[model samples]
Target: MELCFGWFLLVASIPAIFAQDISHGSIVVDGTMTVAQTDDNFVCATIDWWPHDKCNYDQCPWHYTSVMNLNLSHPFLAKAIQAFNRLRIRVGGSLQDQVLYDVGNLKSPCHPFQKMKDGLFGFSKGCLHMERWDELNRFFKETGAMVTFGLNALHGRHKIKRSLWGGDWDSSNAQDFMKYTVSKGYQIDSWEFGNELSGNGIGAHVHADQYGKDLVNLRRIINELYKGSQSKPSLVAPGGFYDEEWFVKLLQTSGFGVIDVMSHHMYNLGAGVDPKLVSKILNPDHLNKAAYTFGNLTHIIRRHGPWTSAWVGESGGAYNSGGAHVSNTFVNSFWYLDQLGMASKYHTKVYCRQTLIGGNYGLLNATTFVPNPDYYSGLLWHRLMGKVVLNVESHASPFLRSYAHCSKGRTGVTLLVINLSNQTNFIMNAQNSINLKLAANEQNISRESFTHSLKKTFSWVGTKASDDALLREEYHLTPKDGYLRSRTMVLNGIPLELTSTGDIPSLNPVRVNVKSPITISPLSIAFIVFPNFEAPACG
Candidate 1:
């Protein structure tokens, strides 16, 4: 009677155990449903348009004077650059418009200008020397970064007598700058005309039609200057916040094939010092707010500029510089990784993070020059994610945001799962009779011993796998300890740090047996790679 009662209890508890309010989701990897083919140069960073003196890493024992002169040759920065294969560098920001190119040999290297009230905007009306430009080019050449130089277009704008109306701007100074660029034998991949001059604008405003006309003039000059060259660089424009009507007008006026990449800036968080910055990052809704802009831009591009690719030219999340501790810590990865996944899903070709070496949000610390938590997140994405994006659906909880893509060169798919809930864990499984049964049993049994064993399940419906082809790899990104808001990040329980010799440590992922459901802890992000599932669609 005792044995029979025990057996009966187990059988009756099956449904109750699995039915507990644990969120259940599924990832549908239908080959027919395809997202955009992500660009090989998808992960990009930036060097602000501001001068070196305005933003400098602390002079510690390392004795780094200026970021402009920071040894790109250093093993640390060099290796980080090389890891991405081809990381594009957007060398411009709010200050690009106020900067002047000094082609003449001037004895005074620094041409001082008034500091703007916003401290970070405009290069202080200073003259950037030819020597500095050359050094910058060398750094680019050495780092294998595709350079996009934002030219000073606002300097040429005139004060027309029309109220609430602006005239087409001139590009004579830009023309001179390009001519000098070609003469110096510096290969600029693209020339961006302006910065933050969109919609109502930031520091300065320009009418959309006027900006379009300026782009046409710049395009003509680029064509003429690089006539004999094998290939001319593209003309990128209006790097600023997305204003739908203004952007569409810019596209319509510029016409087809003029603007190569339709780019915009994103600083969703109102300010860097907002008291609720941490809560904002932790909130899934706040982080996913960018979807509106990404979706809107994609639609506009497809409607008017079908050939032009969409890109987030500069995104630091919080404007007026980023939050000191919040922007650079492990918690930011929740937003950073989610942004990458969301942007890619919405067909954003390139997502350039703001201030690669300056500000609090930089991947590398401004003072220590050390790689922050976001740096590893970027490196892992580059190494694990591929150009072909696959459809992923997580119906479990709003907190569990999922993205999938065919492994870069590997056979199966790589799934990026982000759990936004700080109090809930998640489980990811392949949706199949065999796997589902196994997952149910594992969850029911594991819960008996482990208090936090009830994980939100993500079941995927795709290609069938052989018993032998069930091997998977998982890279879990979380805080060094259990704390969600922290400065350090650990992958599979190991913190990624620079060696004593300033070298990148090996980022090893935890191997998993795919037959068993994978678990993702709370407030964490995981990259699940299925290498052995040879899906025909992925191929």
Candidate 2:
């Protein structure tokens, strides 16, 4: 043996563990998240079809006008203006005649414009209402929200004398209205020629070829009327439902570039709205399914020829008056945020959420003008998240799915995480060291009254009686039902709770060490802000 006494050497390997800690605080960050920019990205809030008419309570009490009037001045509108620069007012419904008359002539009587009385001559009789227009303009100025007006295309109103190429157009009054809007310096960005023209129930039903022909004629009149005007509005056509075949035919026959945006409506009601079916509307997984539908439509339109953009011109969680219970719950916020996020993903520029303050699915409670969970969700997106989309990667779990965006310039990163599981808990670990702030609340804020447990109402954003003065005055209920309470956890500092007065109680932003993990409770929506982090690397 060359070496009789070979020394045995042993090496012990030590595992590398990265130590990290996170901090929490109050003062929820706003407008500090980043999102990716794509050609298809545009933000828009919806103006209900026939908003002026829909908001007139005396005319449509169930639709609620008072709240609509208030929304014109609501801080929420300003927030929306900041977030999305575009808006659409769907113009056909039971209230179509009223809007046409009101927008056409300001002094027109509120009385119903009977088709028998207001034949072709009667349509132009109403005077354009400048007062309401001023009110609308004032809000637009404050928020910088542009408008897309939807034209009423129901068959009997405006008819095409011939086929696609030449037709005696009877839309002089509508043309004048566009002229007036331009004269007033109100920029009508685009005019969608109709509501869901292919749908059978509400409006005039027409085949794809007939609708496409009518659309071409309508475009001609709009172009002829506003040819030299600064407010030349692009004409959109045949707002389709889920009829893909119809959409394909319309795109093929309709001349290219005639329509600025391809529009469609989607409401997922797998079956009827029974108790079991209502839950589907607010389900987070269900939200992703709607995005796939939107994506497919975008691809179909692209296949025809490139258009300016695509928009979910008219959409809500439910089509048949919305669901009973789930539509009003705080859980709906997840659905709303998810829809916006998904629309952004597909590069769909503008998403007009069905009705702002009517229908069971309205973002605001029609009766009180109080903001609903969806409204709060909108407010959060407007205030905190910026337009830029960032690459957010998360470990997938059925219980939790998240999207993250860095605010423009990387001031902060916002993680919008949802816990879909009814009972399972989830933990989120940061891949890098970053500062964090958290705010969370449960989906349900309603409580049974002491007098009658059977009757329940939203106790969070409305008035209620309580023995304590502080509790009685606070509008929103907290985890305690009497006081607003939320905790902020920091890495090495004491956790602080938010007070009923909406102030953070002496909490400071604590630094979180690198590679720390943050845990989330079940059925909660938590917004985490990461400050002082480097911009994520982008290709």
lDDT of each: 0.73, 0.49
Q: In candidate 1, residue 52 scores what lDDT?
A: 42
Q: Quick one: how many clashes does candidate 2 have?
A: 31
Per-residue alpha-carbon lDDT of candidate 2 for residues 299-359, written as tens digits (9 for 90 to 100): 8877884774677776666654455444544655556667776766565666676566665
Give candidate 1 regions above 4 Å deviation.
1-25, 51-75, 104-123, 159-168, 432-464
Clashing pairs in 1: 95-122, 426-456, 427-456
Model 1 C-alpha lDDT per residue in residues 1-539, reported as the tens digit of each score: 43454366358546644644345455545444467777787888887644344432331211232324455555677777766777788888877776767754323344644556643343356666677778878877887888888887776455453222365554665676678889988988888878888988886778888889888888889899999899789888789889999999999998888899888999887687788988888787887778899999999998999989888899987776677778888988888888888999888888889867777778887657778889888888888888888766556888888888778766767888888886665655554223334355664455543332222122233334332534578787879876765778888767877777887788886665565666766777889887754344566
For lDDT, the strongest prediction is 1
TM-score of each: 0.84, 0.65
**Each candidate: how many clashes?**
3, 31
Top of the candidates by TM-score: 1
